[model samples]
Target: MSATTYDRLVEIVTKLHDAPEDRISPDVTFAQLDVDSLTMVEISMRIERELDVHIDDNELEADLTLDATTKLIDAKLAA
Candidate 1:
């Protein structure tokens, strides 16, 4: 995934979850980030609104890492 997309995801996650930027790595999972279902929804909405990409809810999971989400977003953007 592009650094831009990864950076943006980091930004969104940190902002929404009140997580420290340093704690947010590509390998970090949503559960590790303490992101709950409600926050996940907010993240999804923010990604769509900010990135103009649509990611289905089924595509997001607590076990998903930042890298996986970035790759998913990249794939959607590519498509």
Candidate 2:
């Protein structure tokens, strides 16, 4: 998954949380990582800036899992 959306998402979360990517499997939720509201906002912005995708801020209100975010990013890219 190198250079893929999934890998990017995992790398982002792992970087923020200082956790190993493998410890942050696809199904792991942001809540599990103690992600705060502010951090979510930061993440949202980073994803948009880094991926050049206009992800709605509301996306963070839904499932904030790496896998889910990857899917969202991929779908947006496909569109």
Error of 2 at 70 (Å): 0.7
The 10 consecutive residues of candidate 2 with the worst lDDT sum are 14-23
Q: What is the C-alpha RMSD of each candidate to the true structure, in Å?
A: 2.3, 2.0
Write the residue-wise lDDT of candidate 2 on 1-79 in tens digits: 3498887777666665666555678888888777887878877887888889877777775357778888889999999
* Candidate with the greatest TM-score versus the true structure: 1
Question: How does candidate 1 score on lDDT?
Answer: 0.91
Residue-level lDDT tens digits of model 1 in 1-79:
5559999998888888988777888899999988999999999999999998998898889999999999999999999
Error of 1 at 35 (Å): 0.4
Error of 2 at 62 (Å): 6.2
State in Å the error of residue 59, model 1. Answer: 0.7
